[model samples]
Target: MSDIFNQVDNSIYSNAMTFLRVPLVMDPIAAEADIAVLGLPFDIATSGRSGARMGPTAIRQASINLAWEGKHFPWKFNLLKKSKVIDAGDLVYSTGDAAEFTQKVEKAATQLLASGKTLVSLGGDHFVTLPLLRAHHQKFGEMALIHFDAHTDTYDNGSAYDHGTMFYHAPNEGLIDPQKSVQIGIRTVFNEANHGFNVIDAPQANDMSVEQISTLIKEKVQGMPVYVTFDIDCLDPAFAPGTGTPVCGGLSTDKILKILRTLTDINIVGMDVVEVAPAYDNSEITALAAATIALELMHLWTVQNKQV
Candidate 1:
């Protein structure tokens, strides 16, 4: 019915730009979907990189290939079979104004959540989580964060606009529950003293099996409303070298996917895949990884919220 299927049947190169060639809608409520894909293209807060602003478009381009895959592996059902998903396009905000941008992000996210459709966000940078958290909290109260990153992002205090400082404010501002939250694959330095978050640092994660990590995550969250924010940098530099701040050692893509596959009923409310600066990516792997992750998030949403 669509050019995505008609002209490019099974082709990785599709003429459609919307993620997976799903309809691009400005009016999400009119789209009648169970999930809304929102793009946040503000990257002014990046401390180490600036190109993540282009991430959303690159991710969409990469996802053209996924639209042709009938059934995603490991999951027997097609993600879209049970419900509708609309790409609500990218959030618009004033250019170059970080303060105004955060407000726009929060306002737009709040509006999407108001539609009662789960949101799968495509991020400009890790800092975008701040506004997202604010909006999600207003809906689900304080959520337990399932953060995937190379840095703890709990810089404690300093540089309010920096991506590294979002968690420092998120819990304090009541957007997330630090005690119920967990940061996985962290290799950077951050204060740990009773900071509330349970951290599975890179070394610790590497030593543990994927099942062990997944069990730990499930235990910490314990059915609390969860918000998953995945930084592509959480993958080792060999896997995701296009991110702003690349760390040498981190979770392998296989390890992260294995863990996520086990999180089928963890009460996830919202999710995002951030920091795919395509300029530095090798052979589009970073964008493809982000797209695959995004699709998996959709699978998680669909299968868990199954039709009664």
Candidate 2:
């Protein structure tokens, strides 16, 4: 009999649902893959709408639309050819228990990092980044954060498990250096008094050229290990209406892509794309956007490795 698991199946509609049609290997270390894709499917911490729990499935399914593009455009080489990438599937945890979710995610991440695999995560909500940061910090020490969102996620008044408060706790835990961090596309209200992070608000980001924006980001992070977290609500509701707690007047998808494309040299060690709730989406655009951004991140990793 032929080895069915090793057979190539790139059909857009008929195949096992893995991100970008990559092999689904639950044990990434044993497979000796360079990149591991993991999903966090818990959104109990969301303060607004709840369907972000379904985000992982939506994002993976939408990635089928991008499977046919071997080189992913503009980029000079094929991503999967340059590096071995596999979907490790979603994190399994006790439903509705926030503490358990945190423990499981951090432990899983630590294991993957210890095995020397670059992790690309898909979020259930923005809260997931805290544990992810904890795992990355243990392996790489303190990191510079590159956050893309409509909110700073720095609210000090929220409960222990709120999604809007991860950054507030992350700095306190010494997982990231706030002074070395940059928060982009923020339009919502946040304390300006002592937030520490360099804020490039929505209006400011729109006014600046992509080169200027990329330069500012590189200056802030400056040779430190970087962790990039993109909250889908950073895009205006017109571009990503499927997210919970979306604000108006945010960055356009085109502009964000341009900025990301220019940052191929930054030392990004880990990344995640969050808040893609498909129930509110029109024509699957939000999930597709998330998938494309995730793929771009992989290309960034591939290019960085090539440079090294």
lDDT of each: 0.87, 0.92
How far residue 144's Cα lies from its native spot in candidate 1, in Å, is: 0.5
Clashes of 1: 0
Stretches > 4 Å off in candidate 1? 1-9
Query: How do the residues 1-308 of candidate 2 rate in per-residue lDDT, one tens digit apiece?
Result: 56977667778777748898788897776778888999999789999998898899999999999989887877878888889899999999987899999999999999999998999999889999999999999999999999999999999998888999999999999999999999999998888998899999999999999989999999999989999999999998988999988899999999989989998888999999999998899999999889989988988888888642
Candidate 1: TM-score? 0.95
What TM-score does each of the candidates earn? 0.95, 0.97
Q: Pick the candidate with the highest lDDT.
A: 2
Worst 10 residues of 2 by lDDT: 1-10
Per model, state how many residue pairs clash.
0, 0
Candidate 2, residue 286: CA error in Å?
Answer: 0.2
